[model samples]
Target: MRQNLLMIEDDARLASMVAEYLDQSGFTVAHAGDGHSGLARLAPDTGLDAPDLVILDLMLPDMDGLEICRRIRALPGAMGHVPVLMLTAKGDAMDRIIGLEIGADDYLPKPFEPRELLARIRAILRRKGEAPASNSKALRFGTLEIDRDARTVTVGGKPCDLTSYQFDLLVALAERAGRVLTRDQIMEAVRGRELEAFDRSIDVHMGRIRAAIEVDAKDPKRILTVRGVGYVFARQQD
Candidate 1:
C-alpha cells in the first residue's frame, strides 16, 4: 500500500495542490484546513487510517502549528512516532529554531517547488530507518545518563520522557562530548541526511533535550550554543 500522509494547511488552494501532488506521488493524502479540525481528523474514532507522515503548516486558523506538533508527539505508542515535516511562510532563523524546538522533524519554507518538497519527504522517510545503530552505548555526565540502545535518557537517575527526535539530538551531541558539531554535521548525524539552511529542527530538539537533562533549562550548562557556529556538550568538569 502507498504510504499515507496527513497535510494540515489553512490555505484551501495550497492544500488541494499539495494533496494532489502527494497523491500522484503515491501517497494516500488526507488534508485539513485548521488545527482543531486537523486534530479531529487524526483522532482514533475517525476510522481514517493513521498517516505515515504529517506535513504541518505553522500558521493555522485556530492554533499554532507548534502546539499541534507538541500534541501529536504526546500521543501514546506507535501513534506518536509519525514523522512530521513543518511547512511555513516564516523563513527566519528564529522561526526555524522555534519549530525544531517544538519537536518538528523537518521544516520547509513557503514558495517551495513541488519537486523539492517531494525530495524532502523522501529524505525524511529514509532517515526514519537509516539513523545509525546505537550499539546500546551509555554515556554518563554529571546528573545525565544516556542509553542509546534502549533510547532512554535519565536526569539524576530519573527517566526523562523524550521523543525519538529529542533522544537522537542528545546522543549526537553526547557522543562527541566536549566537541563542537556544526549545524550541518549535527543535522546529518541526527536526521541521517543533508538538510537545508534555516533548518531549526536541531535547535528545537536540543531545546527539548536540555529541558529534560539540564538542572536549569533557562541557563543550560551541559549543551552550550556556540555563536554563529554550532553547539558543544559540556562534559562533567573533573
Candidate 2:
C-alpha cells in the first residue's frame, strides 16, 4: 500500500516540486501552505485523512515549526504517534535540536537532495515497521518495560511517551545491554545509516529518551555515557 504524507511548507514552488518528487517515489503527498491549514488537515473532522508521516518546515507563515510539532504530538490517540520529519535551514543547529526534543522523528537541513529526503523517509518508515526479533517479544529492566510487539514502553507501570525514532534507539541500546556500542554502530543498528563526523543527533535523541524513561533525567542510570566512546545500557537496572 502507498503511504500518505503531509507536507506543511510555505514555499509554494518548493512544495510543488517536493510533492511531485515524493509522488513519483510511491507516496501520496498532501500540501498545506501554512501551519493553520496543516493543523486543520490533521483535525479529526476535517475530512482530510491522517497521514502516515508529516514533513514540516521549520519556518511556517503563521506559526513556528516547533509549535506545530508540539500540536501534532499533543493530538489524541494514534494521531500523536504519526512520525514527523522536520525541514530546517542549514546551520540552524538549534532549531534541529529543539525540533527533535519536541518529538520530531527526524530532520533534514535545507538544500537537501531529494534522494537524501527519500532515504530518510524510507529509514523512518522502516524503523516504524520493525518488530521484535524472534528471540524476544519484550525486554524488562527493573521497572522499565519495552514491549516490542506493541511498540510501547512503560516505566514503573506508567506509559512513557517516545517518538518512533527514540523508541527504536532505546530498543537498540537495551537489546545490547551492558555492551558499549559506538555511535556509528547505534545509528546503523537503528537507522541503517552511518554516523557522520561530528554528528550529535544521537546524543540529542538519547537525552530525549532518558527524559522519558529515567527517574531523574539529570543523572541517568539506564543509558550510561562512555565518554570517549559511546553509550551502554546498564545490564543491572534498579
Candidate 3:
C-alpha cells in the first residue's frame, strides 16, 4: 500500500515539484499551503486517513514549522506518531535542532536535491518499519525499562513518551550500555545515515530523551555525556 504523505509548504512551485517527485517515488502526496490548512487536513473530521508521514516547511505564512511539528505530536493516538521531515531555508543550526527537539524525525535545508529528500524520506520510513531483533531482550536499568519487542519505555513503572527516532537512539545506547558512542556511531546505528558535519541535532534529541526518562533532566543519570567524545548509557545506575 502506498504511504500517505502530507506536505505543508507555502511555495506553490516547490510544493508541486516535490509532490510530483514523491509521487513518482511511490508515495501518495497531499499539499497544504499553510500551517492552519495543514492542521485542518490532519484533523479527524477531515475524513482523510492520518498521514503516514509529514513534510513540513519551516517558514509557513501562518505559523512556524516547529510549532506545527509540536501540534502534530500533540494529536491523539496514531495521528501523533506520524513522522515529520522538516524543511528549513535557514542555515542556522538552531532551527534544525529545535525542529528535532520538538519531534521532527529528520530535517533538510532548502535547495536540497530532490534525490536527497527522497532518500531521507525513505530512511525515516525505514526506521519506522524496523522491528527488534528476534532474540532481543528488554533492557532494565534501575527504575527504567526498555521493552525491545514492544518498543516502549517506562521510568519508575510509568510510561515515558518518546518519538520513534528517540526510542531508536535510546535502544542503540542501551544496547551498548557503559560504552561511549560517538555521534556518528549513534546516528549510523539508529538512522543508517552519516552524521552531517556540525549537525548537533542528535544532542538536542538526546536532551529531549533525557527529559522523558531521567529523574532530573538537567542532571541526567541514564545517558551521560563524555565531554567531547559522545554519550554513554550508564551500565550501573542509581
Candidate 4:
C-alpha cells in the first residue's frame, strides 16, 4: 500500500520535486505551502484523509514550522499522534534537538538526497509499525502498563499522552527493564539505525516520556538517569 504523506514547505520548487520523487517511490504525497495550510489539511472534519506521516519544513513563509509541529501535537485524538518528519538545515543540531523535543518523529537535514529522505521515512514508519507486533503482550511494572500491540502506556490505569516515537522509546526501555542502556544502544533499539554523533534527541524524548509516566518528572522514579552515562528503566516501580 502506498503510504500517504503531507509535505508542508514554502519552497515551491523543492516541494514539487520531493512530491514527484516520493510518488514514484510509491507514496502519495500532498503538498502544502505553509504552516496554516498544512495544519488545516490535518483537521479531522476536513474532507481530506489524514496522512500517515508528515514531512514538515522547519522554515515556513507565515509561521515557524516548529509552532506548526506543536499545533499538530496539540490536535485532539489520533490526529495529534500522527508521525512528523522535520526538514532542518544541515548541521543545525540545535534545531533538530528542539524538533524532537516538540514531538517530531525524525528529521532530515536540508539539501538532502531524496534517497536518504526515503530511507528516513521508511525507517520511521517501520519502527512505528514494529511497535504493535507483539501478540498484544502487555508489560506490567507496578501501576505502569505497556500494551505492545496497542502501543499504549498507562499509569495507574490512566492513559498517558505520548507521541508515537516517545511511546516506542518507552517500550524499548520497559522491554529491557533494569538494563543500563547507553544513548547509542537506546537509539539503535528504538530506531533500528545508528545514532548520529552528539545527537541528544534520545535524551529529549526520554525527558518527554518521563513527564508523561512519572508522577514527579522532576525526580523520575521509573526511568532513572545515570549521570555521565545513559538511562535505565527501573524494574521495580510503583
Q: Per-residue lDDT for 59-141 in model 3, tens only?
A: 99899999999999998877888899999875768889888888998899888999999998888888777888445788899
lDDT of each: 0.78, 0.90, 0.89, 0.87
Clashes of each: 2, 0, 0, 0
In lDDT terms, how accurate is model 2? 0.90
Off by over 4 Å in 4: 131-135
Residue-by-residue lDDT tens digits, candidate 4, 1-238: 8999999999999999999999998999889999999998998889666688999999898999899999999888778888999999999898988998888988888899999899888887887777363556799999999998888889899999887778888988888899999887887777645567777788888888998999999999999999888999999988
Candidates sorted on lDDT, descending: 2, 3, 4, 1
Worst 10 residues of 1 by lDDT: 127-136
Residue 79 lDDT in model 1? 60
Pairs that collide, model 3 = none
Candidate 4 clash pair list: none
Q: Report the lDDT of model 3 for residue 22.
A: 88
Model 2 agreement with the true structure over 24-133: per-residue lDDT tens digits:
98999889999999999898676655788999999987999999999999998777789999999999988988999999999998999999999999988888887675
Error of 2 at 42 (Å): 0.9
Cα miss at 121, model 1 (Å)? 2.2
Q: Distance (Å) between predicted and true CA of 201, model 3?
A: 1.2
Q: All predictions: root-mean-square deviation over Cα?
A: 3.3, 1.3, 1.4, 1.5
Model 3 lDDT-worst window of ten: 191-200
TM-score (all chains, Cα) for each model: 0.77, 0.96, 0.95, 0.94
Q: Which runs of model 3 end up more than 4 angstroms from their true locations?
A: none
Candidates arranged by TM-score, highest first: 2, 3, 4, 1
lDDT head-to-head 2 vs 4, winner? 2
